[model samples]
Structures are given as C-alpha cells and as structure tokens.
Target: MNTRWMARSALAFVCCMAANAWADRPATQTERQAMGFDDPAQLVMVRDLPFPADSDTRAPDGAGLGDEWQTRIGTAFQGRTGAFNFGGQAPSIACTSGTERFATATFDLPAGAAIKYVDMFAYDNSSSEEMLVFLLSVCQGTGGADPPVSTILANSTTSGTPGDTVVTLNLSSAPVIVDRYTCRYMVRVNMASPGGTCVGGSIFLDKVRMQYTP
Candidate 1:
C-alpha cells in the first residue's frame, strides 16, 4: 500500500468514527441550539390560590376556599347569594345558581417567564345536573380596568357528568393562548345554562397550574 494512500484512508476512517460517535451520543448544547432547544427555562412556581378563607365571603361552606390558592368573585352577581365555597366534599361546590354565574381569581406569574400552558383539574359534584358549562379567562396588567383576554377553556354543556372528572385544555387553542407575550393573568370561572331544566349544581376545582416553557 502506498504511504500517502494509507494516510488518506486512515484519515477517512477517523472522520467516520467521529461522525458515528456524535450520532450515538445524546444531543449536545450546540445540537440542541441548532434544533431550537436553546436555553429553555423551566417553569417556576407562580401564584396558586385555592380560595375561600374565612375572610372570603365567596366560599360556600364558610369554611372558606381552603388552602388551595384561588381567585374569588365578590357581589358581582345581581341576584346570587351565598359564598362560593371551595371547601367540603363532593356535591358541596356544585353549581347551583339558576342564572349565568361568574367567579374571579388573581394569579401572578414571575416577571419574565413565558407562560406556555395552563392546566385545570375540576370535578362535577352535582347529583341533579349531569353537565356543566364553564369558561376560563386571563387578564394582562392589573385590575378590572385591564381588558381581559377571555377564552372558553371548557364548554361541557352536553357531555361530562357528576363525579371526579379530569378535563384538559390546551392553552395553545385560539381562545386560551390570547397572545405570545407573557404578563400577569387572571382566571375567571363562569357557568352558563344550556337550556332544559337547568339543574343547579356545584363544581370543585382541584388544581390550576401554569406551565412556562421559556
């Protein structure tokens, strides 16, 4: 074999081995950046309000909303009476109001984090009403003065029945995401009638989490 040829062949083999090694190893920093995975920030804990402390007149049980963080709505309803209770077992928090119901809560995300997703876990505790309708809204900036970007996260006027149920809403949907920017957002829980005998029931929201994929 010619020495020059042998040297060239050896170089090619070395290059092949290097390529294979790179392929076998997990994605590296440079490779991830090339694939748009650059420095993605992990979602940190934001505000989590369960709602209805003794001070909160909205909770039904008067036990208040419990330890879970939640946004509460005060005398916003015209004829509605009774605090929207967060505490108590099944059947307690079921929506019982005859008219459109609205409840408000505040949530604070860290200053610069981009909220990628919001997950809500709720249970239909009503025995009479088989279904419920609800909406979740988020507001930017502060107070009622701020125009809220509202989305009907869950509209279960037909399906879903009473009992422990899990519903997932993708924030990427048109109504949920609102915009690409990240700022402080509020979540509003609204219940509406879908006609028929309008059964009064309660709904217990277990958990609401915001996922920030920065």
Candidate 2:
C-alpha cells in the first residue's frame, strides 16, 4: 500500500508540472496556423485612423463651413466629387473661380503614433485643370497662416487621368513619427480653378486612405 501511494503521488506531480509548463508556453507554429493567426511580429493595429471618412458629410449639408474640420459633423472629415470646381468643395467653403482651391481633410493622431503612408484614390480626366493630393504637416490649419508654417511631407502624381488610380505617399522606409503638440497632418486636394465650370468639372476624388502605426 505504501509503494502504491508513492507511485500515485509521483504521477500526479508529473501531470501537474506538465500542465504548468504549457500554461505559460507560447503557442507552437502549427497550433497558431491551425487557429488562423497572423504572425505576432506583424501585428500592427490602427488607433487614430478615421472610419467616418469612408462616406461622410455629403455636398448638401454645409458639411464644412467656417472651419473644414468639424468633429460634430461626421468625424471631422470632408470629401469632393467635383461639384463647385474641377475637383469638389465642402458646400460653404469657397469654390471660387480663377485661383486654385483646395479640398482638405484633417487628422488628429496620438503622440506616439507613426504615419506609414497615405493613398489617394482619385480620377483625373481634366486637361484644363489638375487634381493632385499632398500629405502635409501644418501649424494650426489657417492658424499657421501669417508666415504659413507648413511642411510638404509627400505628394502624389497628377496622371490618374480618366480611370481609377491610386497615388501613394509611401513612407514604409521611414514612417513619420509624431507628437501630440508638435504634429498635425492633412490631406489636401489641390483643385485648380473652382466654380469656373461647376458643371462637368473633370477631376474626381474617390477616397483617401491613411495607413499608420500606433
């Protein structure tokens, strides 16, 4: 009976140790693959990227009036399909003739976030005017006006004429690191000559996508 009890105790201890070992062990490669899990090293997630901009603030609602970025009105975003100009406008925002007009969308990111790249999916069919996008860091929107403290980070080409084109500001080589107080970014659509040909303006904007790491 004594020998039997000792054998049972040893087996129980071995079982307990095996359970404890696996409790803290990382999943094996085969197990991870069976669960359809991505590699942990490539587990980048989006934190500040806007979801509302997918389809926000249509042309009729005075969506972007005094200030372009309004959090109350559709998550502080604006889009253009070329209504007031050769590109588009935010209803109340000036889509004047002659001078170049811009349809810009703003983004607010956390301090430690990093900007990987921006993709502007656009269609540029206008030979008279142009529609090119730029990613920039501005000091306070118009607040950086007096001297215009602006830095042009990256820009896309204007050759997406008559078809679907994706212009990218890829910085995968070196992502733009940011801080809350020091960095504010925007995607500006340089729409040349607003209101001149409100009817049938050539360039059209499909969407703007920002890929980042937080």
Candidate 3:
C-alpha cells in the first residue's frame, strides 16, 4: 500500500466524520425561527444630522465644571441644539479642554417600528491625541435627566494615531425596542477622560442609520 494514499484516505474519513457531527447538532427554537430570517425594511429616517467640523462649538475657557455644552442644530429641527456635557468628578468626564466640542442628536422612530439595530460612524480628528472615547445613549422621550431604557453602550477610545476618519460601531449586541408607545431616542458623543488636561480637537460623525427588524 502506498503511504501517501493511506494518509489521504484517513484525512477524508476524518472530514466526513466532522461534517456528520455538525449536521446532527440540534437547533434551538430561536435558531429554527432565524433559519428563515428576512430583515425588515427601514420605515423612516427621522433625523440625520452630520457632525462636521463646523458642528463643533467652543465653550468658554475654564467654565463651570458642570456646565451643559450644546451645538446649535439650525431651524431644520425647530431651532433645537444638541446638548452634551462632561460627567462629574466621580466616574468620568467628557472633553477636558475648552476648544473641544461634544455633539448629540435625537430622532423619533416611527409609531410602530421595532428598532433592531443602530449603525454609527465616527471620525476622531485629533492628530496629537492618540485615543478618544464616546458614548451612545438611547432613551424613551427627549427631555431633562431621563434614564435610558437600555444600558449605555460606551465605546472605548479608538486610536487616533492612525489618523482621524469615520469608524463604524456595531449595535447588534445592544438592540432596543421602539414600538408605538416609544417616543424618542438620543445619541451623544463626548470626550472620555477620568482626570487629565483635555486637549481640544474635532471629531466628525456621519452615515448614521437605524434599521428595523420587525
């Protein structure tokens, strides 16, 4: 018997056994439903605001420690300006310097739409700074100091050493339900630093889309 032929025969037999094992695995109820999965079409795009270079507004130098920083959203959305701020000294704070700007926006999902996913693209435009962190918050209605229905999806500071450009964030792990009863959802981007001198620069956000998988 040829040694090469014998070796080839053994490999073939092992591959067949592995395939058989995988085919015999049981499927869960959810898996069975997902087998015929067809994602839902997007119903509406309520607010699509771009965080360009001009979107950033400088705050007063050494302003109050706990002040609300906002970016004007023009008359397009009823003269609304997105609100953002640095967290207190306890956990973490937003942009450390005065020139840095944090931007936020709110959008209303359709009346009876189930929000399956949210896709975010952010550009960290800081040449000297190597890293920057941002936060995404989802809430029921748009108002003062309300808790988010889902947990806060905080993205670790991505390396800016490679140069500032758009980076997409996957929201499959943090899906929120937006049905007829739901009112509004908010997305906030802020500088993430515990206690350090904040360097001021610009970050761009674009191509933000939400899909409903009803």
Candidate 4:
C-alpha cells in the first residue's frame, strides 16, 4: 500500500480506539429504543472542520490567544467527500512567522451532545522550534459573525517529534457539556513560535480529529 494510505489506516485505527471507550455502554433512550428494539450499540458523533486554505482571516496580533476569536467561513467538513479527494494542494493553515498567529474555525455540534475527546493531526517538517498549539473553546455567537469566547475547554501542544512526519496530538481533558444555544464550539490554532525552517510550508496544521457522542 502507499505511504499516505498507511498513514490514514493508522489514523482510523487510533480514532476507533476512542469510539471503543463508549462501546458496551447502555444505549441512550433516544437511540435504538426509538427504533423499537433494545439491541446494544454505541453511537459516535464526529464533526470535522477542514480548514480550507482560503478560510482563515488574521486575528488581532496583540492578544495572548484568549477570547480574541474572529470570524471564519465554512460549515463542518461532513458530507464533503471532495475535501479528501486531493490531487493538488490539500486544505490546511500555517504559521506566517515565528511570532504567534491564530487561525480560527467554527464547529457546528448538535445540541445535548457531550464531547469526549478533541484531537488534531499536525505535520512538523523541521523540529521542536516549530511547535503548534490546538485548543477547543465555546463562545457566544452573537454580534454578527464574530463571537466572544467564554471558556477554554481543552488545549494541547504538538511534540514536534518524528520531525518529518505527521503525528496526532490529543488535547487531554475531561468531557465538557454545552447547553447554551448562543454558545458554539470553536477550534483555534496557534502557530508555532519562531515557526522554524519548515519555511517550505512544512510545519502546518493538517486536519482536526474529534471523538464525541450526541
């Protein structure tokens, strides 16, 4: 098999491991019960936002990466098979310079959904000098397109290990619930400091991985 396919297989296996956690658990009342049967089956809800190359806008460079989330365009990457059908440039975002820059994306998660894990796939071409930060947040989507962030649910940093390949990074945190309709899920990426020699556009945010249930 090709190297890309192998990488994808590994990623799929890793993702399944997360779903396995919710397996064997009692089915939710709204689930199989509504179907008129009591068969045991776990439900996995995943919402992916493929950071389209043209979707990011420059955030205020003066903030410390807090409630300064700006607006971005696009819906969840779900149902977009064309997104993965890559022949040329794949979708992604990168650090402009060594100074920290932020690219934000919106995630449309179902109501009453409990998030299990927030994961991100990162590509590090140079070294540790090009580490990136991935975070999950919730904010009130008021004031038009821009939303004011309220809480930072989870955050994680890339190891920059295996320097030339893509690795998975999990934002280690417990499950958090969001009930407010005005508030929405946010995925913000803080590009690495001194962004490194990966200047060939090597060091960048690849794709986001999410494991949760609705």
Among the numbered candidates, top TM-score falls to 2
lDDT of each candidate versus the true structure: 0.38, 0.50, 0.37, 0.44
* Candidate 4 residue pairs in backbone clash: 98-194
User: Per-residue lDDT for 1-214 in model 2, tens only?
Assistant: 6999999999998996554331122444543332222445422211222223344333343222321211211123343444333324532222334333456777777666666667776656666655556666644433443432344556556663665566766554445666557557777666442222321345556667666666
Q: Which residue pairs overlap in candidate 3's backbone? A: 132-157
Alpha-carbon TM-score of each model against the true structure: 0.39, 0.49, 0.38, 0.47
For residues 143-176, what per-residue lDDT tens digits would candidate 1 score against the true structure?
Answer: 4564443323333232355666645333222222
Rank by TM-score (best first): 2, 4, 1, 3
Per-residue error for 92 in candidate 3, Å, reads 25
Candidate 2 Cα outliers beyond 4 Å, as residue runs: 1-100, 140-148, 193-199
Off by over 4 Å in 1: 1-92, 98-100, 125-158, 172-184, 196-202
Which window of 10 residues has the lowest lDDT sum in candidate 1?
42-51
- Over 36-149, each residue of candidate 3 has an lDDT whose tens digit, in order, gives 112222112112122224422223441223322222121111101233333223222334344333344555555544343344444445554433322233335556455434
TM-score of 2: 0.49
